[model samples]
Target: MLQINNINKAFGTTRVLQNISLELPKGETLAVLGRSGCGKTTLLKIIAGLLPADAGEILQNDQRQNELPPQRRNAVYLYQEALLFPHLNVWENIAFGLRLRKTPENELKNRVEALLVHLGLQAEARRMPQALSGGQKQRVAFGRAIIIEPQVLLLDEPFGALDPETRSQMQDFYQKTAEQLQLSAVFVTHDLKEALRMGTRWAYLDQGQLQTYPTREAFVRDPKTGIEQEIEFWKNV
Candidate 1:
């Protein structure tokens, strides 16, 4: 469980987040929809402990973690770019975190190899990141993040740079991977359809305020979310 209470953030005089609060249950994905620069990424960064919140309580599984650093938070932040190490092959990239912790070489190899097969990337184990396609690269990135078994996965517009077909494919992969691993995730996006498709729980963030819906139907029908218009527009098309 990830608990956020009265989270606040500001840059100089401008407030980025205003008393934001939300709870994320274990193994649940909360899809957040917001406009650019509306503090979506800021919220994720706060939870991941990459950025400090002016005021708030961050709890993980009933433990207080507000003062914990990013490394101690056991959270991973992933952005749109794969940002994979160009110098490392797929095998090394996935095992990178494990090796950082100095896991046994055989254990690291086994874990990395298992993740490779799980992500259907065993054929590309020896290939460099530049040799892979967009979807494949994102898969590698995902594998790298999950191999360390972080408690929370914070994804910031991860598929925004992909083509429509690739975006959909990656979305499917994300859903399957999270479910299979029982990973808790917070996915931030601007696209309505993508949010609806990817999240088990839906929330809309506008001007630093967060609102969640009881169901997808409610999410789409709620006037404040502006998702109803998108649904109607697609129906007409």
Candidate 2:
């Protein structure tokens, strides 16, 4: 389980996160929705140990994670872009992390091969990043992240680069893959419909505050909750 307790972060004079708290169980996906500049990505980065919280604590399995660096933490972050290495072949790119850790040759080959099969990219294993489609590149990125078997997966608008048709396909693939891997995921997006479809429960963020709702229906129905207002705000942008 992942536990975030009263996380607070500030940059110079600007405060980005305030008293953010959340508990995520294994095998669950939580979607975070907010307007732009609401600090959703900052919060996700803090959880992934990429950014430090000015206050509060992040705990995994009841143990403090303050001492762990980003690479040491069992959390994977997928950015808005796939961020693949242009010079590396698909197989080499996916195996980069394992190689950095000095995994044996046989084990590395087995692992990369399995990921290629799982992501339906076995045929493109030797292709360069520029040769693959958007969805295929994103799949390779996902495979690289998941191959490490992280305890938490953080996605920051991972499908934003794809066209609508590809976006929908990738979303479905992500949902199924998360379930199959039994990974706890925190996905950040501004799209309400996407959040509702992908998340088991939804979190609403406004002005650096976080509130979770049990269901999308309940969240949309409550006028005073500001969820509808936030969605409208996103649409205008």
Candidate 3:
């Protein structure tokens, strides 16, 4: 479980996050929805140890991690753009983390090869990131992050750049892969439908405050979520 205890952060004189608290269960994905600059990314960065919170505590399974660096946090952040290394092939990128940890060559190869098949990239193992399409590149990015066996996976609009059709496919793939891997994740997005489709639990952040919805119905019914507005807009189309 990832326990965020009344975390707060600010930039200069502006408050970015205000006393945020949430409990992310193990093997569950949290979908955080908010407008741009609403502090969703800041919260994720703090949990990943890329930023420091001005108050409260970050815990992984209840263990304090306030001072841990990004590398030591065991939480991988996946950006919207497929930030694969320009110099590495698909196979190399997936194996990069394992190599850094000094895993045996044979074990590393097996792990990367397995993930390649799982992500339907077996045929492109030797291909560079430039050779893959947007969806494929993002899948490779996902594989790279997962191969390291992170305790928490942070996704900041990871599929936002894909075309609508590809976005739908990626959401389906994300749901499937997450369950198959039993990975814990925090997904940040501005799209309500995407959040509803991809997460088991939902949260909303606006103007530095946050509220969580453990069930989809609650999120849809909440007055501040704007989900009903989006739904009504689509229903008349």
Candidate 4:
């Protein structure tokens, strides 16, 4: 379980996150929806240990991670871009983390091969980053992160750069992978439909304050989530 207790952050005089608190149980994805500049990324950064929180505690599995560095925190942050190593091929890129940990050669080979199949990258294993399409590159990036099995995955609009068709495909792929691995993640996105599709639980952020819902129904019922507006817009069309 990941527990964020009264997390607060500021940039100079501007408060970016104010008393943000939420709980993310293991094996579930908490989809956070917000517009740009709403501090969604700031909260994720604090949880990933990439930024200091002026006040609050970050606990993973009941252990405090406030003072831990990003590498030691057992949390992985994925950005909007795939950010795969340009020099490495798909298989090598996916195996990068395991190599760093000195995983047994046989085990690493088996694992990487399985992940390539899982990611539908088997035929592209030898292809370099530039050779793969955007969706394929993102799949390789996800494989690299999943190989290490981080305690929590912090996604910062990971599919935002993809075309609509590829984005939908990636979302479907992620839902399957999450269930298969029983992954725990905090998925951040501005798209309401995407959030509704991706999250088991939901939250909204505005002006640094967070609003959480106990169920999707409640989240959709709330006017601030814009679900009602979306429904109305579609109905009139």
Candidate 5:
């Protein structure tokens, strides 16, 4: 399980996250939904160790993750953009992390090839990011993240760049992959429908605070929670 306790973060005088706390169990997916400037991305970054929290601690199981850097956390983060290496081909970009960790050539080849197949990117394995469609690039990014088999996965509007049709397909692919890997995922999105489709449980974030719902039905029926309010707000957008 990934546990976040009283996490607080600030950028100079601007406080982005305050007393944020969350817990995600293995094989469970949690969606973080909020309006712009609500600190959703900041929270995901802090958890992934990309940014330091001013207060509180993050833990995996019982191990302290306070001092661990992004690379040491075994927490993979997928940004809004695919962020693939401009100079590397699809296979190389997906194998980048493994290469950094000195994984054997045969092992790397097998793993990357398997992920390519799993993500339906086998035909594009040799293609450059520049040659792929928005949806395909996102798939490659997701494939790279999962190649490491991280204990926790953090997604920050990973599908925001794709069109509606592609976004829906990617959401389904992500859910299935997460289940297959039994990954604990924290996905950040402004789309309520996407959240409802992707997460087993939903967390509503407002002004840096997070409140979780046990299920989507509970979230939708109440229409009182921040998530429901945001959902209604976006319906007309």
Candidate 6:
């Protein structure tokens, strides 16, 4: 389980996160929906150890992580960009993290090969980053992150750059992969449908505060979520 306890943050006089708190149980995704500049990314950054919270405790499976660095926190953060190494091919890119730990050569080969097949990248294993499409590059990124099986995955609009069709496909791929791996993640997106599809638990963020919902019904009913407005827009058309 991942728990955020009374998290707070500020930039000089401007408060970005105000007493943000929530829990993500194992094998679940907490989708946070918010418009641009609503502190969603700030919350994820704090949880991933990329930024310090003015005050809060980050707990992973009951262990406190206030002072741990990003690498040691066992949480992996992926940006909208795939951010793969330009020098590495698909195969090497997926194997990078395991290599960092100096995983045995044979085990690394076995793992990377399996993930290649799992990600349908076996045919493109030797291809360089530039040769892959946007969706394919993101797939490689996901494979790289998941290969190490981190305790938590932090995604910052991971599919935001993709075209509509590719975005839908990636969303399906993510949902399947998350279930297969029993992934525990915090996915933040501004797209309402994406939020509804990706999250097992839901929350809304605005102006530095967060509101978590107990059920999908509650989330849809909340006026601030804009679900009602979305429905009305479609119905009148």
Task: Highest lDDT: give the candidate number.
Answer: 6
Expressed as tens digits, the lDDT of each residue in 1-237 for candidate 6 is 999999999999999999899999989999999999999899999999999999989999999998999999989999999999999999999999999999999999999999999999999999999999999999999999999999999999999999999999999999999999999999999999999999999999999999999999999999999999999999999
Query: What's each prediction's TM-score?
Result: 0.97, 0.92, 0.98, 0.99, 0.92, 0.99
Q: Is 1 or 2 the stronger prediction by lDDT?
A: 1
Query: Residue 137 of candidate 5: its Cα lDDT?
Result: 92
lDDT of 4 by residue, 1-237 (tens): 999999999999999999999999989999999999999999999999999999999999899999999989979899999999998999999999999999999999999999998998999999889998999989999999999999999999999999999999999999999999999999999999999999999999999999999999999999999999999999999
- Stretches of candidate 2 above 4 Å error? 224-237
Stronger candidate by lDDT (4 vs 6): 6
Q: Per-residue lDDT for 10 in model 4? A: 95
Q: Write the per-residue lDDT of candidate 5 for residues 9-128, one digit (tens) a residue.
A: 988898888898888988888988788899998898888888889999899997989898888999998998999998999999999989999999999999999888898888888998
lDDT of 2 by residue, 1-93 (tens): 888999999999998899999989998888988888999999999988889899999999898997799988889999989999999999999
What candidate 1 gets wrong by more than 4 Å, as runs, is: none
Q: In model 3, how large is the Cα lDDT of residue 40?
A: 92
Cα error, candidate 4, residue 24 (Å):
0.8
Predicted candidate 5, C-alpha RMSD: 2.4
Ranking by TM-score: 6, 4, 3, 1, 5, 2
Off by over 4 Å in 6: none
Reference-based lDDT, residue 59, model 1 = 92
Candidate 6 achieves a global lDDT of 0.97
Clashing residue pairs, candidate 2? none
* TM-score: the better of candidates 3 and 4: 4
Model 1, position 113, has a per-residue lDDT of 89
